[model samples]
Target: MAQAARRLGVQMACWKAWECDRAAPQSNRLAMMAGILAVSPSWLLSGIGAGPLELEANDRAALLQELQIASAEAVASQKRVQQIVALLGSVPVAGDSP
Candidate 1:
């Protein structure tokens, strides 16, 4: 559970730490389970008592755009690292003459 939180970049404090402004520990536990399963927190807790929070069309679009940007950046970084590796390999060693 902690490893999953770390992979998602969520702090353990978000799940374990006591916060006066937030929900209680039980609520937090439910929320954590929902997060792990990628489902609605309320739905996970209440079993369809209240409807799920629907994402707005624009919000979904914005999220997709952000994901695309992140993917592009990751690919660019990988290419840059590969280029650096190739450049390093091309450098000749002084002790080993061709």
Candidate 2:
């Protein structure tokens, strides 16, 4: 839900409320959410179409592997960004151009 909220540019609380049935997403948001979940919008809205999509075993495995790689890359990228910020912080600001 946190991931969904982040991707949707909504507050986590709002997503939680949606999940908990405290509120519902607008029609436009329904399509976006369905796309994110890989389900038919109609199914998400009313179980009118296929309820939820299921991946084949091999496809699921491949997706899990891809997710793992992406997660690792994201962590590495964050570390690099933190290192760059620290390095920049160590450098003194110049009052005049050379």
| Model 1 segments more than 4 A misplaced | 1-33, 39-53, 92-98
**TM-score of structure candidate 1:** 0.45
Q: Residue-wise lDDT of candidate 2 within 1-98, one digit each (tens)? A: 88988888789998888888899999888888888877888988677886665789999999999999999999999999999999998887798444
For every model shown, what is its TM-score relative to the native structure? 0.45, 0.54
- In candidate 2 the C-alpha lDDT for residue 6 amounts to 86
Q: Please report, as a residue range, the 10-residue window in candidate 1 with the lowest summed lDDT.
A: 15-24
lDDT, candidate 1, 1-98, per-residue tens: 58755754567676444333354446656676666656777766556655445789999999999999999999999999999999989998799889
| Residue-level error in angstroms, candidate 1, position 89 | 1.3
Q: Residue 59 error for model 1, in Å? A: 0.4
Q: Which predicted model would earn the best lDDT?
A: 2
Leading candidate by TM-score:
2
RMSD (Cα, Å) of model 2: 6.6
